[model samples]
Target chain A: MKVLAPIAAHEELEMLAAAGAEELYCGIVPREWLERYTGAVWLNRRSPKGGSLDSYAELKRLVDDAHKLHLPVFITLNSPYYTAEQIPLVLELAHKLSDEIGVDALIVTDINLLMRLSQEKLACELHVSSVAAVLNTEAIRFLLNFGPSRIILPRSVTLAEIATITRDVGQQVEIEVFMLNDGCAFEEGFCSTTHHHTVGAFCTSLSEMDTQFEWAGKSFTTRRQNWLRRNLTDYREWVWYVNGNGCGVTPKGLPYGPCGLCAVPDLQRMGVASLKIVGREASPFKKLASVKMVRDIVNRTRAGVPKLHVIERAKQLRESPEHCAAGFMCYYKVDESA
Target chain B: MEWSLHIGGAHELASELWLSRFVEADRSQLTQPWSELAGRLLVTEFGDIRFTHCAFGNEFCEHLIPSVSALQTALTAAQQQQLSFTLLTPYVSNEGIAALRPLFERLAGNGGGEVVFNDWGVLNLLRRDFPTLIPIQGRLLNKSLRDPRVTPMYATAPAPSSALNVLQRSNLDCESYAALLTGLGVQTVETDNLPQGNDLSFAQYGLRIATYAPFGFISTSRICMAAGLHYRKADKFQPGAPCRHECQTHLLEYSYTNSPFGNRDQKFFLKGNSYFYAHTESMLHALFAQIRAGQIARLTWQPRLPMTVAH
Candidate 1:
């Protein structure tokens, strides 16, 4: 399995590759683009601190370094959608990444951009980012019109569902799965709220506070309102409802690293081309650790480790044994007991 | 200019109000001139295409998605009622797309209804498999960043020019973007009554525009607090966790405490699986002027109704 890791700079390239990153991806924000939109309207999903390369020259250097290591670099242009005004600049960046930088691929979600890239006939392969929300074969078939070479599946699907998709469309293009890090409680493409808060994404913070629920009628309000108010302390349960697991740095929380390492054997058997580890904004230390962990799993599974032994190893890698105990932290649901 | 009424389903807007039955089904029935309305937008399931407050995790939600039979029956009934139909769809997974293929094909077979697609996949499917179905861009895909935090800023005197520009610029405001969508077989687009307001200049771009009045969707999430209420534990607060359709049972109001500009005091309505806010009468009237001037060709009247959760 190709371990795709997030890249922020040339400095992290060698370490990432040495840590077993076979492929790399990052976002670029040129000075002109930043001056216009600022960090508020991110050209890509990551916030300003979300690991965007400052200049095209920096990106080109990163690409060159990855090429020396014989690794391909994919650029993320995968914001949910871009405005028409933003498209020309975005396309310019796409062409530069393809021809000038010699990047292997451009990860995109906007169909307008996808159609433009196809029409423009850029050099690099187009990768449908999970932001496009390609959840089904029909969605895949839809993306096929633009001719993407790889599709990074969203973190939301279960292993069974992933198996079904790979079986049906796996042969058509390279299928990628979220092998490690950053799982959203909600679907990425459909989420419209700005994730630009300095603390964390506002969507992820829904469970942290209480919001008053009001409506038009009296009896309706009285019954529903009083019941909800009475359960103010229990509202923490509701927070968990919004966040799939509670928000914490611990393994038990929903915002915690939702790892799919346990499901690697099945994913490989199903012909998944790559396992993605999200964390472009994370520290190099964290990125290196993630890469090492997934790389180790890839090495073991490829060397034909027994399922039982691999399962035991994966349990140790998790935040806590109980993190996967309920099968919630498993990026892809595995049938094995924790 | 045209005016159409949008309802969740026949359950909400029956042929006649079922006064004897229950309030949920009876209270908000369309009558009078609306009965003869030329177009009716029936949401079979809140389009998975949009971010809804309730999510069943992945694209396909057993609890949230409506069945093919239900959609077909609704379409046929709409036809009998002499109301033109526009099928609204959500962002979905391959399974959800596969599930809806028959329905898309059926729509094609049934004289090709207008399909309002929030997901590009649905649009692509229409182009490939069901070409005859007229495709309109749904409001969800009309992604103009509407952060409620900025509403108070717009209300303030000397509002920041940059924020104003961002607010005023609709995704369709760029002529080329509208042209691109037009090239993709979408001639019509739907929009929310945004507080920052819309620059309907896209009308000059040769696209027909529609807007939902008095209930602009600020944003939505699959991590629906409403769905979470039914879950006994945080671990159980996931998709396919045996929901009892708590969204239909109740509505929640959310307010932010640390909001800048006292924006937290603004109450956003959480109904079913989505967050919505009512537009002011003045806002509606101003938009009505645009409709009269033909900038916006259609106005979709969405009457507030009790949550009617469906299959």
Candidate 2:
């Protein structure tokens, strides 16, 4: 269970560690936080030309060329809340990424910057962000008193709620999950909207908007609300449906979004130590064909194979062919009897 | 400094003249009885001390799990309305904290209950196992920006002061983030009356805020397209399927004409699944002049029910 990915540059670190990427996460935003929060505040949740990195000397040479190939970089001060003059420039860039560019973990998602990095002990490894929704096991025993080593999780739970949180706290912490690109139909830490200026990612413009079905004491020009809006014109039965379907992008176009690779054999029998792969503003050759297609489906689920031939070898490495039977570009969903 | 009446589901038409019922519902229409609730509700007032979601979990909509005989008949009708109960949680998973340990031991033996935590793991499981209830802070932890397509462009422009300070600032207006939510005993914070307005300056961080009104949930999803329209299979609308509650049967009215400043009539409301934006009475008379300038001490309100009613 290790693919992680998403590094933004320093020449995409040896093609994302020669297209396997054991671990790499990123986000930097320098140039004085894009000349004073120009993307209307964002030192993380991307946008300094998205998937940041404009110096800490190019994130100390992309964490010294991905820690000479053993990977491990992490670093996205995942914003879901951060103000108080932007918390001392996000705790002076988390104390220069933990005292001058050493970063091995900081993902975060503002529970007041995880209680100010566990009340300023701030050494490094913190993780927690799927914008900190955490989802159960009492929010991982309430972020195990903010000494996180990993949490990610929230893509709105269920793989039997991630096997009821890695079977109860899966040995205290480290869970990670979303094995591929963006899928949120809202729940990124209770989505407060404004994902970026100019209608872009407010949950993908909340699926091309349009609604009105009033009647708890009438009037939207009630005639049974105009015959329930001209016979509910079937915008695929709304509630912001969304299913454009894309196993495509990145000729520097970059959006090979939503791809669970049929839930990597139940997130490796729910041990899920890490799968991640979201596109920190993608395209390092679509993050090297999504870290060589989830490192060849996590090495064919560690070579034990047969989860229906690793989901027909992850539907022939996602040329889809209706493999995940496209349930809105499903990520973990793959049941019709596997 | 308190008005409350959120009631998310069928509490025999709630109303006993305020003082609480953020009573949302889910664990099967929260033990129904507002004339057998199958949605289409809208009554007001409060009392019969009820505020629910025992285990505080909801990304935006999908609740109702209460059963310990429906929290012992909603705690014997909130101890015959001597009222002192509140529980609306969400964001839980150690199997929803082992299925909310018998509704946190029935709100820790009901000694004046109250528990609205939008998951700081249920305020560290009510500060290590229900230390006699009372936590309050859930408006999905109030992250702000409640977008009904940019609240009509932050209600007619002039919002670029870093987008009106990230839409009326709040990390509980930092004083060490309100002393780390009042050192976790969390005195109260649940707010959201923002149709592009609300600078009740996090009521200077001392906590005790409580605002909510006319629907303020900008996001929520256990992947329900109104409980996947009786599943003729569109991935059976995802999240553990089989929900016949059908957003308590109908309510999905969205209408945003692409406002990235293109701006046009933007109305959004969808009952019982989550997506709302409706607060004008001059935004409740500017939240009643910030509840008579005490900078909002409590309001809660929410009329237009059936997001499966259980606040």
Which structure among the candidates has the greatest DockQ?
A: 1
State the fnat of model 2: 0.65
User: lDDT (0-100) at residue B143 of candidate 1?
Assistant: 64
**What TM-score fits each model?**
0.84, 0.35
Q: Identify the candidate with maximal TM-score.
A: 1
Task: Please write out the lDDT profile of model 1 over residues B84-135, one tens digit for every residue.
Answer: 6766666665655676677787778878788877777678888887889888
lDDT of every predicted structure (CA atoms): 0.66, 0.66
Per-residue error at A241 for model 2, in Å? 18
Error of 2 at B8 (Å): 9.1
DockQ of each: 0.32, 0.24
Cα deviation in Å at residue B297, candidate 2? 2.6
Tens digit of per-residue lDDT, candidate 1, span A30-133: 88877786656677889865688887777878899789889999988987666667778888888888998999999988777787888888889999988777
